[model samples]
Target: MTPTAVDASIQRVARFGATERRLHTIHASAFVVMFLTGLVLYVPTLAQVFSNRPVVKGIHLVAAAAWLTALALVAVLGDRRALRRTRREIERFDADDLRWLRRRTPSPQGRLNAGQKVHAILQAALALLFTVSGTLLWLSERNTDLRLPGTIALHDWSMILAGVLVAGHVWIALSPDKLPALRGILRGTVPAGWAASHHPKWQAPPAGSAQRAPRAGPVRLVAAAVVVASGLLVTAAFTGLAFT
Candidate 1:
């Protein structure tokens, strides 16, 4: 129960629900796939080595679509209250968050720090730019003289910024002090002591709720499927508009 006891056997607290874990999994996996495929498409040496531009491009596009779909899926099917709360948490920044960002203080922090919020914002913005730019780039192949200057520039710059964020995120997650959080994301819980120290501001689920225990069960699968399908339908409509 001691804060210094970082072992797995220590008492656990519910840091993430199954929905959050699913969303995180999909986002991380999709991003990795897109990043790798994008690199292959962008690097001349890698392109030559692969000698299959179409395949690489195809994979990247698929990963991007999947990423978007997964987010929408979670939004529609996940716990609305929890999702809304998380959104507010990410958007809310106060003096405490500022101090945390400046490394001035560690206590009185919420589940997410200022840097994490900034990371989320930058990630969402970059993803939007990448998708829009990528769509145009893809369409150009089929439409002669449709090539638009600066499209590639936007996409490339987005990739560069994403790479930077991903690098920093990795470094932070691997640090000794942050390993508990990393495990929390992977397992959907962290030591109660760790939570008490790092995220003292974190709100535990209400009393009499079974959330304190390790509960990794997912949301309803059928419901999640419906949500994912709806998301795809919406994406299709937008894609239709883009093509027009």
Candidate 2:
């Protein structure tokens, strides 16, 4: 009674639920506003063209607030179970995930490949840094004591790193091979065949046929976590100097 290949190719599988899409939509929309406004604020040449610096600055602040608000709203109203599961998936990496990073041909070990997981981690960390540094910079304008040299550099560097990641993400999403994934995120479903080919580990299983996949050693994982945390702490300490 197994389905034929043709049947699988045309079958639609749920790739992302409604809550996920909504969160992504809000995040993306806010990011666009922030990035564009940030460009004007960061680039001297663009700032010259846009003479109304006050308005631009206001818009940039508003966008940053919206970004923070979006996360809060999602936390209060979004599917808690789904969000938790996604967080777990993005945080853990298995042997397949490690291989996925070095050899691109093989299917990722899960719904999110290793690279995607890494990108998600970086984005979250950078977003936190951006918020912290941006807030300090905004307040520093009024309270000279809050002014910190490292704060501005952290904010600007975060934006640059995030920009590069976003660019690569967009390029991959737009590529023909990856278009199905992009469409899945947008529409919440994808051809089962495509999912099978791209993420075999996540192929829609028959009812009551689910099982857990094996994971890799935790040494590297712990080391990576410590490295990221150390970097963040160093930057945080450097930025906090102005306040102290």
The model with the greatest TM-score is 1
Predict model 2's lDDT versus the native: 0.73
lDDT digits (tens) for residues 1-244 of candidate 1? 2233233556666677666777788978998998898999889999999987766766676667778778876666667667666789899998898887788565487778788889988887887898789878866876757689999999988989999999999999999999999988877767777777877887644212323323224555666777678667655644443344
TM per candidate: 0.79, 0.79
lDDT (Cα atoms) of all candidates against the true structure: 0.75, 0.73
For candidate 2, write residues 1-244 as lDDT tens digits.
2213332337666667666787788878888888898899899999999978777776677666656655655555556577888899998988898878878657456777798899889888988998899989877876899998899889989999989999998998899999888877887766666777777787564322222222324754464455556545544443344233
Q: Model 2 — which ten-residue stretch has the worst lDDT? A: 207-216
Candidate 1: the clashing residue pairs are none
List of clashing residue pairs for candidate 2 = none
Measured over all alpha carbons after superposition, the RMSD of each candidate to the real structure, in angstroms, is 5.4, 10.2
